[model samples]
Target: MKAMRLEAIGKLFVREVEKPVPGSEDLLVRVEACGICGTDRHLLHGEFPSTPPVTLGHEFCGIVEVVGEAVKGFKPGMRITGDPNISCGLCPQCQAGRVNLCANLKAIGISRDGGFADYVIVPQKQAFDIPLTLPPEHGAFCEPLACCLHCIDMARIKAGSSVIVLGGGVIGLLTVQLARLAGATTVILSTRQESKRRLAEELGATASFDPSEDDPIGGLAGLKGLLPGGADVVIECAGVRETVMQAPKLAKSGGTVVILGVLAQGEKVEIEPFDILFRELRLIGSFINPHTHRRAADLVASGKINVEKLISRKITLDEAPETIRNPARAGEIKVLVMAGT
Candidate 1:
């Protein structure tokens, strides 16, 4: 087996290693495809929760090369994707069904070996079986879409409401489509990249803006002459402090703001208390996927979310290191690691 491990901060190594053996409660997946995520970048730079000298690929899917004795309903050739957050199920938060807030939780790639190798092992509890006929690459999207689905679930989006998604990355694009399906009458995407903005428009955003080129908030006001009534819901997916602060400003009175982006540790932003006191806005912080991983697989299988457009680059495992260093390598949007290909 060839594995890509993060030896330490700012370093990754692809080396030969022995394939793992599946335990009774585990399944050994033959890696087919994996997606390089923002978390991976953060982990590489020591910004996220990952121990040094670990195998560091997470967003992925593969064929079940072997299944443990206790793992049933899955065969040697089953295709699946799931990396359940390992948590104390008996903890207060887990008992309250808020397992994302569990006192002790460790993610698969961040806590242990992940899918950036020829084979990876995971508990059957975290694994969701996908139809073997589904392309492995599509299976790779299941995890990310699952996380986005969790956020969408938190939003409780109303039909015909307006939504402004601030960011045009993979998560932002998914948020746009999900908001549209939730019945948002007008979906707006704010991004500085022309290509991303164009793609958002093509996907479903009624409008797109380049903030680097102009004031997005002001532009909308210019058209409507009334600040466009702000958005009924402002979902900040950019994960930057400035954009997070702007979420409140972009949201209308009595509206909700869902923070979906990951911020750095010790990061802070300023928000006026008067605005919250007078306008009555709801602020929510969304975490990782909990029970929605399977639902994400269903959505992808049903062809509800178009992940194909977001996939801009697909490379093999050997190129993972360079791809990790350069975000735009090969014009990457969602750069995938095709392990077996």
Candidate 2:
């Protein structure tokens, strides 16, 4: 099997490797499609924590080529999406139903071998079944969509609520649609790329603005601004220091701010403590997908979330190493690696 192995920070390559074997309670999923995430680049650049000498692809979906004897309710030939974040059930956080904060959290792609290959092992518990009738590429979106669902749950968007989504990347675009579906009447997207701003508007953002052209705080929330007093909820998806620092300022006095972005480890940004205390704003951090993969798969299978339009391009596994090493292309959304291609 051909797999892209991350030998170490700043080193990655496509090498011929032995196929993975499934454990008693695992399923050997034949790689169909896997999306290249920003974390992949971070892992390559040592900006994110990841175990080297492993395959690095977490946002993956595939057909079950082989099912372990102990696995039940899942059979060979079934299509499924793998929830990469694996938590130790005995951990204190896991026992408290906070699996995302598990002390022994072991993500498939980050901590162990993951999809980006001909075959990858998926523990039965972490696999969510998706429709075999749907496009193979669409299944790769389940992981990202699940994460966004977590953000939406934290945001608690209500009917007629106003939203501001920072960044227009894949996560930002997906969030825009979810915010709208959650009954947010006004969903705004801010990005530096003009093309992404346009795409965001098409994806249900009530309005889209380029934050690079001017100061977002003054441009969007200034007197006689787009949202008079700021948005009811501000979701930061860019993972940039500027966006993270500006999130609270973009929120209304008592609004909610959710950090859905993955900033580099040890990164720091200046934020005003006085403003948060004075306004009584709620600032929350949303981590990996927890108990939302099934919902994400259902939404994709039922054609609720528009995953088709978010796909920017498709490449073969041989090209994945380079893709992960380089920064995302301008105005690009999701890039998928089609193993079959």
Candidate 3:
């Protein structure tokens, strides 16, 4: 089997490896398609915590080639998407139903071997069944869409409310659709990339802005601006210091701000505590997907979210190492690695 392995910090390579066997409660998934995420780049640079010498793909979906004897409600040839984040059921957070914050959490791609190869071992609990009828690449979106769902849940978007998505990446674009579905009448997206901004508008953003061309905060949040005040909710999906810092400022007083982006570890941004205190704003940091994977799968299967348009490119496993080692190409939305390619 060919696998893209992260040998260490700043080192990633495609190497031939022995095929893996599933555990009693696991399923051996023949990798169909796996999306190259920003976290993969972060992992390569040690920006995110990940165990090296492991396969480096988390956003994956595939056909089950072999099912463990202990696994139920699933069979060989069934299509599935792996949740990746494995939480210890006995952890305090898990007991409290906050599984994403589990004290003992091991993600498949980050810790164990993952789906960047011919086969990946997925525990039964971490696998969600999706329709075999959908395109193989659609399944790979479940993980990221699940994370965006969590952010929407936290945003609590209401009918006729306004939302500002602070990035035009896949997360931001998916979020724009979700915000509209959540009943936000006015949805705006801000990104420096003109192409992404245009795509965002097509994907249901009421409007899109290029932050590089104008002052995003003032242009959208000022008294004479789009909202005439500020958005009811501001979700930061750019995962950069500038966007994170601008999130709260873009929100109306007493509104909410959700940070759905993954900033590198040890990164810092200076925010005004006084503004938050005075406005009584709710600032939240949304981590990985919790109980939303199934809903994401359902959304994808139902064809409600436009996963097809978000796919920028599909490459073979041989091309993954170089792709992950470098930054995402300008205006690239999502890149998938096709196992059989």
Candidate 4:
């Protein structure tokens, strides 16, 4: 078997490795496709914490080649998507049903070996079965879409409400569609990239804006703007300091703001406490996918979410190391790593 190993921080290489075996409660999954996420770049750049000497891919899906003796409801040949976050069931947060906040969270790709290889061992509890009929790449999107679903749940969008999604990346684009499906009548997307802005509109954004050209908040939330008096909900998906700072200002006084972006550690932004107090706005920070992977798989399988259009390109595992090391190409949405390509 072959795997892309991160030998150390700032280093990655493709090398031959032994095929991983399933544990008592695990499944040996043959890697089909894995998406190259921003977190991979962050880990490589030391912007995010990750255990080195491990395979680096979390958003993955594949066919089960071997099932463990203790595993149930899963069999060889079944297609599944693994929720990489493995939480200790005995942790305080897990006991309270807040698994994402588990103190002993060990993500597969971040802490141990992952799906950026010929095989990955997935615990039965972390795997969600999906229809085998869908495209292989579609299954890899379950993880990201699951995270976006959590953000939508926190946003609490309502019928006829207004939504403004910051950034036009895959997360922003997916959030736009979910917001629309959640009953937000007026959905707006802000980004400097023209291609992304255009793509946002096609993906359910009622309107798109170029933040570089004008003030996104004022242009859309001002008294004379699109959704006068601000939007009912503002979701920041850009993960940039500017967008995080602008999120609150883009929301209506009593509206909500959800931070779905992943900012680098120790990053800081200036926000007005007085405004939040006076307006009574609800500001929330959304973390990784928690209890939403199943729903994400259902949505993708049902063809409700347009995962196909978001796939920018697919590359072989041999090309994955370079792809993860370099910055994403302009306007590229998602780059998938195809195992057998």
* Local distance difference test, candidate 4: 0.92
lDDT of 1 by residue, 1-341 (tens): 89999989999889898899999989999889999988888888887877778787788888888889999788888888866477779889999998888888877778788988888998888898888778778888888787788887887788888888998888899899988988888888988888898899899999888777756667767864534678888888878898998888888899889999887756899999899778999888889888888888998887888888999888888998888876664324688999655
Give the true-structure RMSD of model 4. 1.3
* TM-score of each predicted structure versus truth: 0.95, 0.97, 0.98, 0.97
lDDT of 2: 0.92
Model 4: residue 273 alpha-carbon error in angstroms: 1.0
* Model 2 misplacement above 4 A: 214-218, 221-225
lDDT, candidates in the order shown:
0.84, 0.92, 0.92, 0.92
Q: In model 4, which regions exceed 4 Å deviation?
A: 221-225
Candidate 4 per-residue lDDT, tens place, 283-341, comes to 99999988999999999999999989999989999999999888889989999999777
Task: Give candidate 1 misplaced runs (Cα > 4 Å).
Answer: 224-227, 329-331
| Residue range 273-308, candidate 3, lDDT tens digits | 999999999999899899999999999999999989
User: RMSDs, each prediction?
Assistant: 1.7, 1.3, 1.3, 1.3
For residues 69-147, could you state the per-residue lDDT of candidate 2 as single tens digits? Answer: 8999899999999999999989889999999999999998889998898899999999999888999999999999999
